[model samples]
Target: MRARLKRLLPRTLFGRSVLIIVTPLIVLQAVALQIFYGTHWEVVSRRLAAAVAGDIAMIVEMLARHPGEETLAWVTREAFARLELVIRLEPGAVLPEEPDPRTGPAEAELAAALAERVRLPFRIAWPRTERAVEIAVQLPDGLLHVEAPAKRLFTGTVTVFVIWLIGSALILFAVAVLFMNNQVKPIRRLAAAAEAFGKGQDVAPIKPEGAEEVRLAAASFNRMRERIARFLAQRTEMLAGVSHDLRTPITRMRLGLAMLTPRLGEEDRAEAAALERDLAEMEAMIEAYLAFARGEGAEQAQPADLAELIEEVARKARRNGAVVTVEAEPSLVVPLRVDAMRRCLTNLVDNARRHAAHVWLGAARSVRPSGGAAVQITVDDDGPGIPPEQREHAFRPFVRLGATAGAGGTGLGLSIARDIVRAHGGEIALEESPRGGLRARISLPA
Candidate 1:
């Protein structure tokens, strides 16, 4: 039980706020109930019963005044109906204890009160009992006693307190609920904004509103995000510049190799050619680094024909002896940086061409789990396909398969393709193609 309560305790500020605001209110209400009953309940009930005691006192006095048993009986009966008093000790003494049916014994509180030198508890009974039997009390040596009946058990005091307790409890509970909701709102908003930010989507930072500490926390988080963004931007700029500069040296060296080939022997020329292959790989890596830094080819996003782009890449590859086909329909003029989209398509097409003689480019609309649809552009190839386990690894930089060190290009092709697609809020994945070769799929929102 303790462990369950501990688990229910708040692990967050929002939950703590709700607990803080409501817990004390409930406790205070409970305490107030105890005090209300202790302080005024009996006093009120006794006040309602006082009228009967007066009537009984009058009856005893009338008997002393005149020798008339009928008058005495009439006064006693009237007193019994109004005041639920059965046995009331006169001033200065206590009343006797009576049996309680619920406990199979006398109530200890009742016994204790009666035993007190100052308290006198009267037994209140029903009106019908008065008509059945005449009650007589035995007075003590130093105290007076009177007997009465039970018709007046329910007094106005009991009704008033009952109504008050119920109403107060209900009002307190409603106030607690409202307080809990108000306390939890700010934190709930922060959680939603943080989740959207984690997914790398645009989200407005939560406004720093509410309690003082909550506002400070939100302000800190917003500041931290800004710092990290600036750092990433600077880092990207550096990588792009360095990568872009290295390409010039690599280009000049490749041209130098052409000049050297004319003067060297066939064996030496072939060895130099090997070095050229390594240089090309370095060039590709540098290009990928730079492209990642530039972000979406540094092109402004605009509506474009994805099918036409795929067909254009395929046609270029076909001119270079690649068997690639396109199977796509005219659809959305989507928002995309043209240069980045072109680069992604070029990489996928080139990679496909290297693996197979035939590559099929197709488009389809797929439903998302979120009740939305995505525009899917697929590349299918017919060659030795990538293993299922390695499909996910294919998009990593410098990761190559079914091809070697000197395979004529940097492995950055697919990596750059993925980056570009992601920048447009899309995705790329490798899977088995019907043609048995590596299939690269790019999905975007339509």
Candidate 2:
């Protein structure tokens, strides 16, 4: 029951806020109306019915005392002129039958009053002329007919009360919606800023607005973003310094190895060459570390042709003697840091090309599970695929799978690719490719 109610409730803060405000108001109005109808309305209606009934009773008493044509004419004129009632007398006539049962409060009240005050058998015809009630009272001489306006027994207060209640509710609802919209706007801006920051986009601090608590949250988010930026900057600077310091000695050693190469014996030259290769590999590893630390590196996202970027990566792979095919539209664009995304795609393609003979790159528009537009890019290769269990392990830093461990490359390829994709508020997953090898799938918001 609780879960069902939760599902039925409004999902947004603004909608829920309106419900919280209006639900109680509707309930209050309902209760107030119930009270009015139960007590005040009924009392007023009974009093009005009793007054009309008393006038009829007085006329009947006068007719009983003075039974003459002249007196009957005077009574009829006075009733019409004073009470706005139409009266007539039927000589030697009897009532045909009783009217239908009274249903409404005013009809019931008027019937009860006539039974109490007039003490005569009567039939009341409601809405006799769309605005009157015809009452026929049985008499010894004839039937006394009285047609009174329906307004005499029914007060206009109920209509006025209902209109006032509905009008006030409508006005209050309009005000609540306007106020809630204003309060929610600042929160929406804060959320957008947070999402952009998480995606490593350059988002300015949001202005504090709306309620005090919301403003405080905006201020806190700004402070948190500043701290994170400072931390990343410090980490990047430290890694850069380490890369520079290590490269200086490595460069000097390479120069020294080149100088001694010609002077060495054949076997010694071969050993020196092996040493040079090892030195070069070390330098490559250091550069990879620096690249990983640099991350998005102060780059702001802008609308770039995603298809063109994929084609550029394919061209670079082809230049390196790898067979690459790109399947993408001509003008698919999305917001991304060009350099960072290029490096990410390059890493994925390079890893695939190193192990596979042919590489396939494709991009297309897609929809996320949360119903958002996204761009999907796939890097596929026709080589030995990683085990299902080990696919996730491949994304761990420096963790290489056994099948592709022989490929001469740092294990950070997949890790770096995953990092860059996630930094763009996208996702990267390893799946089976149609080409019978690994597929690196990246989904970014469009």
My TM-score estimates for the predictions, one after another, are 0.52, 0.83
The number of residue pairs in model 2 that clash at the backbone is 0
lDDT of 2 by residue, 75-190 (tens): 99999999988899998888876455577878889999999999998988786448988888988999999999977888788999999999999999999999999999999999
lDDT: worst 10-residue window of model 1:
100-109
Our model 2 lands, by Cα RMSD against the true structure, at: 3.9
The lDDT of model 2 is 0.91
RMSD after Cα superposition, model 1: 10.7
**Candidate 2 segments exceeding 4 Å error:** 50-76, 86-150
lDDT of 1 by residue, 1-446 (tens): 99998897987765676567667866876787678667676555454345444454455455547634575466556655665443323444444566422221112233233333223333322234353212233333223344433333234655676677678767866776677677567767777766545434455667898778778878887887688567767877787677658777888999999889889998999899898888876776676666655555335577887777777887888898988778987765666677778888888888777767788989877775555778888989887877888777877777776553345567778888888788777888888887777678788866
- Relative to the true structure, candidate 1 reaches a TM of 0.52
- Count clashes in each candidate, considering only residues at least 3 apart in sequence or on different chains: 2, 0
Off by over 4 Å in 1: 1-221, 248-252, 255-259, 265-267, 297-300, 402-408
Error of 2 at 420 (Å): 1.7
